[model samples]
Target: MKDDIVLSVVLYSYLDRPIFDVMLNGSGIGGANSYGGNGMITGIRVPFGKQALTWRLDGPPGMARNGETVAMKNPINLAAEQIPADAHYLAVNIYPDNTVEFVFDKYIPDRTPRGDQIIDKSERHGE
Candidate 1:
């Protein structure tokens, strides 16, 4: 296996919903992968709130749907920002083999969530 490098950070949380359902800015390494069915990889769902998130770097997980689940096993604690947080956050890095390493701050009230910054990071996912 090659050295594990930072792939992307999935900054999102489900909160009361108990599930994360979107890939923040940073997603897909070595440039965007336009394959797998519709060829568009969309949101990713962690098992529950305040949990680590994972994804298949080998193949795209496809658009969000039922039964599609990922987990935040490494980071025991989730992170949030402010008392009334809009969304939780999880920093993740994807290894070459397709295994994702979630960088869990393990603290509630994580950094602010911004869609603009999200896509901006996505632009640099593989970079």
Candidate 2:
């Protein structure tokens, strides 16, 4: 559907953070963690013109370190021109400092022609 927005999630952090659930509007969509260095989630469908995009982050089940489970709730405002006109995909990047970066991309395929053709050249005459 043209009104559907494709979303993805990425995690970037130096600390070995516990895996956390990614909730959209109070429902779990996927999980992300920094333990594996970097993680990515592709192909999340979000209907356009939604009231709000809420993210509910919670530590994994039964794996809370120090008896403290990480829990955070935030909302992404869609009415603030968060998305660009040329953007067709959205990415949410989370950092250890709880900083979130929303990236808008066109998701265009890399079509730069590869250097595969061999060129023939003669040896330098003055060599």
Candidate 3:
């Protein structure tokens, strides 16, 4: 497992609809909840190399109610040289325009640049 890296992912959205599915390397890890602008966080073990992260959202141009959804994928290179020594977390913010921002951090961030919508998964679910 030496070639594997543990990744903590925080997924959220500023779109009208929440991202219901978040995937890494095309595999589902979790999703971003829209309720109160809250987000969902999950951790996964992936290889230490080039990776692809994708998410599914429902709204505009597309219609969730009509069984239509929009999905976006972004490349995430997990090479050792790319990750900082102290930053071990990955946080993603999905925007209304089907864009996303990826951030690396040493600790899980309290909230995204927007506001107090994100809470630890454990704290949110009382686990």
Candidate 4:
């Protein structure tokens, strides 16, 4: 079987509530924004160009499992070549029936910080 699948992971809160609401991490001022409902993590339109997946993550604290699950889809010809290095962990195997089993790993980066929030706050107060 050819390996072909893509997935991403994030530390989301209130994601497993079984509803459609999902809270996503946002930029500076608004720490997070709600996107989906109960039991929701994200809403992504799939079969998107590879360029659409270049994600930038900020320094995080630890690896957290997203209790909620969301899916994005793409309908492309399956080939061993379409797989990315990050998706290699998916124990790809072809079944005798010609169906492919793609067991993938969660794509996430270790949490890291660019700077000190306390210092930034202090600077603002002094100014």
Candidate 5:
């Protein structure tokens, strides 16, 4: 599986609705490649290179409602070594109380401007 250049991510939603979409692209250790989908994606291409990967998220409008809760799970398959040592990951959480939480794999500086968060290292899980 080491030589596999494709990464597949499948997201399942307990609510049976589209919760969010993800886009990933990067250049470096695996190469330059991009993959994007809203739900249940498969066979995303990843090129070989030695750089960091970036991701973006898109969620449904008015997704947050008071006392409403939803569950989403994304299972990603990729080689662990393909990721950069210092690269971080981003995780977004939508709570039942209409609150949003942004979690990063690495600590974010207090003064870091909005829209400029860096991804270095971290993983996120939702309850």
Candidate 6:
């Protein structure tokens, strides 16, 4: 099986307010016919207080147009300021084929009770 790289980081708000700054490093190579790849991020959605947040990176649709080359050599430094800080979660998913996707979300605790709450055999086996 081909191994992929996935990195995740959680940041907390400094004060009671919902704000945060984040930075990440990433690199990618352009398509074989293209000169180099380009990196971009698209903010999916930022909700209200106690609400969830979501975002992702640009996909194939945003890539270079019809046989063009864009050279990119230096490491890509991604930074976001004043982003929602409520239970923030960020991750970089890199596939074996070099395709990358950035996922961001706000984690909310689940308070619902279900039958799964009861210990199952798989749980006992640490599966």
Off by over 4 Å in 1: 1-49, 57-73, 81-91, 96-127
For model 6, residues 2-117, the per-residue Cα lDDT tens digits are 12222234322111111111223322211111111123233323322222222122225554332232222233333343234453544332221223333445642221122133
Instruction: Compare candidates 4 and 6 on TM-score and give the better one.
Output: 6
Count clashes in each candidate, considering only residues at least 3 apart in sequence or on different chains: 9, 0, 0, 14, 18, 0
Q: In candidate 2, what are the lDDT values of residues 17-47, reduced to their tens digit?
A: 4444555444444554432223445676655
Q: What is the lDDT of residue 58 in candidate 4?
A: 21
- Any idea what lDDT model 5 has? 0.30
TM-score of 3: 0.61
Residue 4, candidate 5: how far off, in angstroms? 7.4
Mind giving the per-residue lDDT tens digits that candidate 3 earns over 1-127? 3786577766656554556666666656665555223343456666787666666554456554533355554455667666667876776666655555666778875456643333344347743
What does candidate 1's lDDT look like per residue over 21-125, in tens digits?
334323331212221111223233333234333433223345344334444344433223211233333344333223334444334323234423443464678
Error of model 6, residue 2, in angstroms = 37
lDDT of 5 at 5: 46
- State how far residue 80 of model 5 sits from its true place (Å): 8.2
Candidates ranked by lDDT: 3, 2, 1, 5, 6, 4
Query: Where's the lowest-lDDT run of ten residues in candidate 4?
Result: 27-36
User: Residue-wise lDDT of candidate 4 within 10-71, one digit each (tens)?
Assistant: 32211112222222222111112221111212332223223211111222344342332332
Q: What is the Å distance of residue 65 in model 5 from its true position?
A: 15
For model 4 the TM-score comes to: 0.18
Give me the displacement of residue 81 in model 6, in angstroms.
3.5
Per-candidate Cα RMSD to the true structure, in Å, reads 14.2, 13.6, 7.5, 15.8, 14.3, 18.4
lDDT of 1 at 47: 36
Among the numbered candidates, top lDDT falls to: 3
Candidate 2 runs further than 4 Å off = 1-15, 35-75, 108-127
Full-model lDDT for every candidate: 0.32, 0.43, 0.58, 0.27, 0.30, 0.28
